[model samples]
Target: MIIGSSERVPLEKCPALVLNADFRPLSYYPLSLWCWQDAVKSVFLERVSIVSNYKRKIRSPSFEMSLPSVIALKNFIKPTEHPSFTRFNVFLRDKFTCQYCGDKKDLTF
Candidate 1:
């Protein structure tokens, strides 16, 4: 009994990437892609707006770097492989207790 307008649609309120019909990356916008806009194959929030386009500068928290704020990116170039056994493994093999003092042996030991 109720009809909703395009503005009332919840899907239209989110920000997403717009891909071309051939499955290529295109421009980004705040509004969600509608069926009338184009054939949206996928939507992702990979890019972060750290600074404005203008000359105005920005600063990150003092805990880390200023320009690159150590933010996580959406896409990873390659999957990370797990590391093999190392000297740390020998320490861990000892149940974190020093073989000599029985004290909790960390990397400092």
Candidate 2:
């Protein structure tokens, strides 16, 4: 999953959608994935990257390289934003105990 110098720019620092051979949308691929795979041939793009010269190349340390030089698939939907209320919920979920130091205190005047 190693992203080459070329692919880094067009992704716009965002995750990419990976599709199967059947063209069925599969899952999101982070930039790190490209770095991990080293090379990817399965790429289908809905909207091509506007930036020219954005070619992704993946290479394996074991002397293996994928074909198609990695495809630049379409951008997926944005992740849902976490609700602000979840912050408070998290505190209550852990009780009054300090998250770092699981201490339970009952203060009295």
Name the best candidate (by lDDT).
2
Give the alpha carbon lDDT tens digit for every residue of 1-109 in model 2.
4434544454333334334334443433222234222223232223322222223534557653323323443555444475345544565666656676677664211
Model 1 per-residue lDDT tens digits across residues 5-33: 24333433322333333333332222223
Model 1 accuracy (lDDT, Cα): 0.33
- TM-score of candidate 1 relative to the true fold: 0.24
C-alpha lDDT (0 to 100) for residue 20 of candidate 1: 37
Candidate with maximal TM-score: 1
Residue pairs that clash (backbone atoms under 3 angstroms), model 1: none
**Candidates' C-alpha lDDT:** 0.33, 0.39
Off-target runs (Cα >4 Å) in candidate 2 are 1-39, 44-73, 83-97, 100-109
C-alpha lDDT of residue 10 in model 1: 45
In candidate 2, position 97 carries an lDDT of 61
